[model samples]
Target: MVKVQQSKFVASAKKLTQCPPEDIAEIAFLGRSNVGKSTFINLLSNHFKLAKSSSTPGKTQLINFFESIWIFKEEQYKMRFVDLPGFGYAKVAKTLKEEWKKDLWEFLNCRSTIKLFIHLVDSRHTQLEIDLQVSQMLEKLCRGDQSVLKIYTKCDKLNSNQRALLSKQGLLLSTNQNLIKSQHGGVETIRLEILKKVFGYEG
Candidate 1:
């Protein structure tokens, strides 16, 4: 059986060279700012504060590496969750914002350790231009060895019909306990998908 044993914050990187030694496969999360990337990561790791969220959007300025351990067939394997800086709607200046866009493209297009891209889109607004563009980009950039998993965040706000329709597009998630189950998706599903993708373990 495959089980995501645990996950922890390893380090933060401002640029590609500053990232820790790329020794293991990585599943990077990419999403627009305020899309609840941090909350999703925290839910998966079962560490509420594993990734910090700010009242102001786009506070995640660095690529955060969260190391996760997997137990399968009585053996342990490792993987990393690369939290790339959120794109769009940041409170930063124009030049810095433009710089961030370049950095993100470089990291995504050139990061060799990346085996999968977890693209999170807000459930309420699935057709945002930036999200659509990013989705297309990831599809183009994906290689034979890589895959893209698009997930919808904050699905609790969606009505029943909306959630049902969204379930067909991809995964739907909400960190809010009172409304998480409404989406019919949760942390375990996300964990299993990551394990299957990066470690080739389905259980």
Candidate 2:
């Protein structure tokens, strides 16, 4: 299991211009509104309140940062989990959506601190246009380096069979397809693989 030593809320940003300095390596979470991005972060950290989670859609309207310190082999390191606002919220204006999109793009493309992008998708939804588009953009930005990992969230909501099927489908949709099908299987397996791939090994 990955261990989170220290987890705390850092700041929120409405634009890339307000992003924190690119000192610590960062990993971002992306998904459509109500996809459980915050919940997943909370689960991983073993802190239910580490990131704000809400039942209502589009509750996260800005970039939220959670700083974590991990210790392994008596060595300490810092990392950040960035909760990015979800797209495809119809209630928001087009210009506002565009602005958020621009902020996301700038953060992904220009931030040297960003090492990986965790693209979350609801397990109940098999196909998503916005998710696909984000994946494509990340693919282009990373240039085939496998910098993005698709995370199928809300696994607890699915039965065994449904989970298995969704896991298969998620792997098929990922940029580095083979990683999702390795010795360990399914979403939980994929999550560990991602931690290893991005952080050089799970803490």
Candidate 3:
């Protein structure tokens, strides 16, 4: 089993160049405002308070990096998880939004240590225009490397029928083959899946 041993805040960067040097593999989370990105990070890390969760949208304004140590089969591995500012519906100044967009683009394109990019979508809604736009961008950027994963969040809000339907659409995480809904095994499933994909962890 893969267990998170230590997780702590690393650095907050407003621009790509200001980000810490590429020393360890990083996995980034991108999504719209109030999409539970922060909550997801905290849950997956098994550290409920590691990432601040707010009911208000646009609370995370910077590129927050968390350095975590995971032990898999008695071996230690260090990884970074980046929480980028939300894309749509943030009640922030237009200029701030533009700056965030610029920084995000640079981080996605220039970060060599980024091993996977998790694009989160709300399970209660269908794919939106912003999601498509981001998908196209990832297509151009990631090319055919399979470096992108679309994760449907808040699956507990959906009924069994809805979850089954979503699964048919291939909206579920491939590693767990289920909906990552609420505070359950969902977080652990995602954590292990990411480790398996990025670090070749058997669990």
Cα-based lDDT for every prediction: 0.84, 0.70, 0.77
Question: What is candidate 3's lDDT per residue for 118-197, written digit by digit as tens?
Answer: 98888887679998898889888883433777788777777778877776553443223343443233655666778776
Candidate that beats the other on lDDT, 1 or 3, i.e. the better one = 1
Question: Looking at candidate 1, what is the lDDT of residue 175?
Answer: 69
TM-score of model 3 (CA atoms): 0.86
Best by lDDT: 1
Q: Which 10 residues in a row give candidate 2 its minimum summed lDDT?
A: 171-180
Model 2 stretches with alpha carbons more than 4 Å out = 54-56, 72-75, 143-146, 169-191
Looking at model 3, which ten-residue stretch has the lowest summed lDDT?
174-183
TM-score of model number 1 = 0.90
Q: Give the alpha carbon lDDT tens digit for every residue of 86-184 in model 2.
A: 776647677976776777787777777778888888777747787788778888888343377777766556565776676665532222335435422
Candidate 3: lDDT of 186?
64
Question: What's the distance in Å from true for residue 92, model 1?
Answer: 2.7
